[model samples]
Target: MAIQPDSAPSELAVAEALKALGPPGLLTGCRRIRGGDEQFLLPAERDSMATRDRKARAASGAGRRIVHELLRRLRCEDVAVLRGPLGSPMWPPGIVGSIAHDEELAVAAVAMRSPSVRSVGVDVEPMLPLPPDLRAVVITSHDRLGNLDQGIGGRLLFAAKEAVYKASFPLDGRMLEFDDISVDLKSGEAATSSGRRLLVRCTARPRILALAYTP
Candidate 1:
């Protein structure tokens, strides 16, 4: 069972926005975080998250709940998504997936193993402008925003880079600096310092969400 959001815009709205960006063979799920979500964590999951405070566990538990449900749909139920190398999620064999959350939302994206797709990543952010000071740390000259509204572009760019980082790490096993990659919103792609290329997609409805995956 999935955790339901306490209020609108509905959780279905968030899931639809994410699903619209996914390609064939990709599965996505989402839900609003609720109080006591941390109770959903399995023993191993809770052990792995031992150091996290209550709020972090709640967010992670919500994300894991979605991950488990997505895996079940993929015919790989009862799987544990542990924090693995570089602190990225380690999925069951033959799966490439990602999970992310903002203060109020959690999302998961999963896809069966495929020669054409190597890794996947997803990120969500509140539908608000990115703070100006932080923009300098995230936006680089190599990045392109296309024609997105200036107000939302900066925040979207931030989310895109985050998604790309999560997707890039599993393949290269390298942590990335924000400048280590460049995003092109018009074409919906990103290029990492390690030469990994990812397809990126974004949606502002319900909330701001970004997904990145190998093509």
Candidate 2:
């Protein structure tokens, strides 16, 4: 279930979110990076924003800054933020990572000591009602099995696909469609028919979150 923005925030909330992250061992010496909203206001981010887009840009920039600073604290230097071939954010060499942000929340995962961790992708989307019309395009016929009537189920499917796209691009350098990956809406999980498994998680409220890692 997704956490409602209206609810009171607490340490338990953070822990609950982390718990949904699946096995920490899968991450192997991985660390969680947390940052407040202020970190997104860097000059570079500000410069890229349109005058009317300042608010949204600032929020996003602060989230990225928070994650970047957390990386620095982990001793990741020469931190260059580049764009991948698909235009997703790229990390410096020797780093595998995933990032998620929604409203006031942003979180990132980094593997500091894992040599085998190669491709990584993370995505965060708010828990809310999705348009009914687009569901067909995003949710394939295969995904319609098992409780497709629920709105939360649909959101999870959408989020899993987004995460798969993020994680797969670095490995295949190709754009993937919702149909390319099959999602189990009931479990809030996804897997590529080729054998890649992504752990999909969601809060009861409506947010869809996922992370994919390739060794």
Clash statistics: count for each candidate: 0, 10
Clashes of 2: 10
lDDT of 1 by residue, 5-88 (tens): 435666878887888887778888887888888887778777766556888889999888888877888889787788764568
Best by TM-score: 1
Clashing pairs in 1: none
| Decoy 1 TM-score against native | 0.93
TM-score for each of the candidates: 0.93, 0.70
What is residue 43's positional error in candidate 1, in angstroms? 0.7
Where does model 2 exceed 4 Å of error?
A: 1-16, 25-52, 113-117, 185-189, 193-197
Q: Clashing residue pairs in candidate 2, if any?
A: 1-203, 1-204, 2-203, 2-204, 2-205, 39-62, 40-61, 40-62, 127-206, 127-207
